[model samples]
Target: MKEKYLSTRRTYRESVRPHDGEVRFQVAVEQTDLLIVAQEDLRHEIASFVFQVRGEIKNWILFHPEFAESLSPVIVDDGAPEIIRAMAQAAALCDVGPMAAVAGAVAQAVGDFFSPRTPNILVENGGDTYLHSTRERVVALLAEPDSGAVVGLGIEAEAFPVAVCASSATIGHSLSLGAGDLVAVRAQDARLADAAATALCNMLRSEADIASVLERAQILAEFGVEGVFAQYNKKIAAWGNVELVALN
Candidate 1:
């Protein structure tokens, strides 16, 4: 039988004691409570990969617009492909264009995680996540509507590990397009998740913009997007391959 373990996914005002032997990394420092979970080794590695990938993205993408546009098609190309693909996806959102920042880097982050060993590695840099390996990973996503609480996403996996990422205007330091507190995206690769989350947030500039954004998201969804979580003007929506989790 397949093995599964569920730890105390915490949503207090402070970080929890991480599962034994897991490396700790700080993405951002804030004065408020943080949502944290103690997962298996595979999930931790994936998360680390996302952190590293996003760190690289912050180094490469945020300020570079032309180069990001240049990467649109080649994102699917291997060798750090995920983030590039994500950048291409993000480019669809703005008049200024994607320009290789948050979303694009997120994709690259997930891809970076998969680049190494084949363990069930999954990484979530803020909201952008990438998953690999054969084990099924169920991730709980935290959103704004739940009043800074945990929302459960009881996702069962197939033969491959999955990646998940989210963005928020009210939380974390990353940029967001919609005003909602949280937006998320899931894909086989972190780059896509990163790009999609950014795109979805962009779509939500206003409720008036929702249709166009969804249209654009769908137009790009054919690019093999698995799921989307978006909020604008105080609303949240989660699309395919996604579920919300609640942890008190």
Candidate 2:
């Protein structure tokens, strides 16, 4: 199903600054809006590829309607597309619906498509991201945009080809069952990071839920989640491999 982009200003995009030797561009196909930073401007290619990925997922959902509507994992039939399988498996691991991983999955799929053609790529869809870099990088956190807060997650060069995805009840358009400001997850797979972020965000109904959710993040380490960061109102906490840093 096609979804429309929000007309409201995407202020968080202001934080996506391109580094030296990189180019930044935006691609919007139906509901999938991506901001890409790469070694070269590949907007045309990225747009075509992401459109194809969304088409495949849409066509697959036509046969398996539950794959798009299920709030829990759904097993795809044989001959499912790789992106569909990735979303399904990640959702199963994080106990979230496959759609929860759609943004990150699309972003990573684009990264995968261009990896061999480029040495560095960063794809951000909605707020979830798929990053591959040869040097250190920092991703801005938009937990409370109204408060003028500035913070980010620092990624070491060693964590290349990683996904840092976020879910929030107070930001963007993604659905959430909790009231937390934000919950970000890092994983080797963008789908897994996206699904886990949604799953963890669903567990946070209040600031009191922060400690318990960070503990839960540790358990998720068994399922490819390298780290997690959570914010609820003025409170913030993190666990595992997360490295919080100030952002200008």
Candidate 3:
């Protein structure tokens, strides 16, 4: 149910079945650790499919083995949106090497579980998250050292159910080249949020660029995320509705 990948932060995913319903929920969590509800058989099947997809993508990245690969040469194996998103996030984090893709892979794998089924699945891996419904807001904890126990902003809402992921150097177990306590990426693509979180974290240097990073996070949200929140010094900047503000 919980796993730490390649010497990085601890990643957790689980399939929970409601005792009274014919539905099972599989959740992939990072800081937020959010989940959605769906039919049991459907949800369980998606979770299993994504796990296998994660294994394949990790293997694919091994062949390319370069930071540039993260930006391009995207692995096109057919699986699910979540799986693809995770692979892309990993490719972007290639600068950190192959291990960078682990979180994204798991997150994406979890998200992909909702392929055709809409409005009942949600997955948040390290902050980058994706949801099928927006009835509720997803708030997540940002692993920031100075942004208080809950990063800059605890939870945010967006246009739809969404993807929000975070990266940190001084917090959590994940490795980062930057000093930011938290780098939040809120987007529709769980993988992009994963990559952006790493990318943004790498850019975190001081309070000066915090504004710019926030702007970038906001810009990312416009693409589909709806909201992107980045916090480093207790100054929190968020874009979009911040769909889920309770995951934290």
Candidate 4:
């Protein structure tokens, strides 16, 4: 799955966010749309940084068009932009295309860019998120748009500076070879979480694939994947540090 929150990005953003009093805002540049929560309103700073980083990525893609179009991992030079290198590394680790990690990588980049200015920050691109905070936050899970969100992951404050990303074959614009409802992955690296979510979602062709997909998530634990939540039809599976909770 590539993009899960395109049509309902705003609604989804509002639902998942904690009511902490932090300033919330949005910035959009072409295909990159971000919902950000920070201790202070840094819309202007974030927008300029996002524009610069996107331009760097675009320029590199122009020189190497295959990097953007490949369905498999591609190597990047030592001098590649930080985002490009992160995507390439994530794709290699998850055995998928670099684009699979684009959303999360961008979110992470933006979050890191302003980390020094704010003690708390959350950057969400589509359904991929990068979070850092001094307090716990709950992120709602929306396996199916029609059902809204019945559950959420309760992340402790200690898990700050983490990434949570989702992918769905049945939900959005992202291409998925599987038939799963949703797959969410958590990790220290947003790029890895994003790519891993996509890779794992591709393994779920039916409800029967849920168990094996969860097993696959366990194997990924060694690679810094903190947790995973998967759903296919009536079956659902979770592994690692995933903390499921009811969402009102």
Q: Against the true structure, what is each candidate's TM-score?
A: 0.59, 0.95, 0.62, 0.94
Better of 2 and 4 by lDDT: 2
Total clashes for model 2 = 0
Q: Over the full model, what C-alpha lDDT does candidate 3 score relative to the true structure?
A: 0.52
Highest TM-score model number = 2
Ranked by lDDT from best down, the candidates are 2, 4, 3, 1
Per-residue lDDT over 1-248 for candidate 1, one digit per residue giving the tens place of the 0 to 100 score: 11111223333233223334433333332221112232333445544655565555555555553554452432323444445545554555422244424543543444444445434444444444455534445565665433544555555657354556666555555555555555666665555555566556645655566565556656556765676656564565666766666566
For every candidate in turn, the CA RMSD to the true structure comes to 9.0, 3.4, 6.9, 2.3
| TM-score of model 3 vs. true structure | 0.62
lDDT of 3 by residue, 1-248 (tens): 12222333333223122334435444442222334455345544554555566555555546645522443335444443444445554544333343455565565555555645644555544444555553444344544333324322233333444556777666667666777666666655565566667767766766576777766666554444445555565555555555334323
Better of 1 and 4 by TM-score: 4
lDDT of 1 at 173: 59
lDDT for 46 in candidate 2 is: 87
Candidate 2 segments exceeding 4 Å error: 1-7, 147-149
- Poorest stretch of ten by lDDT in candidate 3: 1-10
Error at 8, model 2, angstroms: 3.1
Tens digits of lDDT, candidate 4, 1-248: 33344464445665745455688888998888898889888998999999998998899999999888998999999999889999999999888999899999889999887998897999988888899888888878888676578898889998789898999887868877787889999898999999999999999988888888888888888888999999977788899889999987
Q: Model 2, 141-228: lDDT tens per residue?
A: 7776655438888999988899999998877678888888889998889999999999999999988999989888888899889999
User: Which residue pairs collide in model 4, if any?
Assistant: 2-174
Which residue ranges in model 4 land beyond 4 Å of their true spot?
Answer: 1-10, 16-20
Whole-model lDDT per candidate = 0.50, 0.87, 0.52, 0.86
What ranking emerges by TM-score with the best candidate at the front?
A: 2, 4, 3, 1
What range of 10 consecutive residues in model 2 has the weakest lDDT sum? 1-10
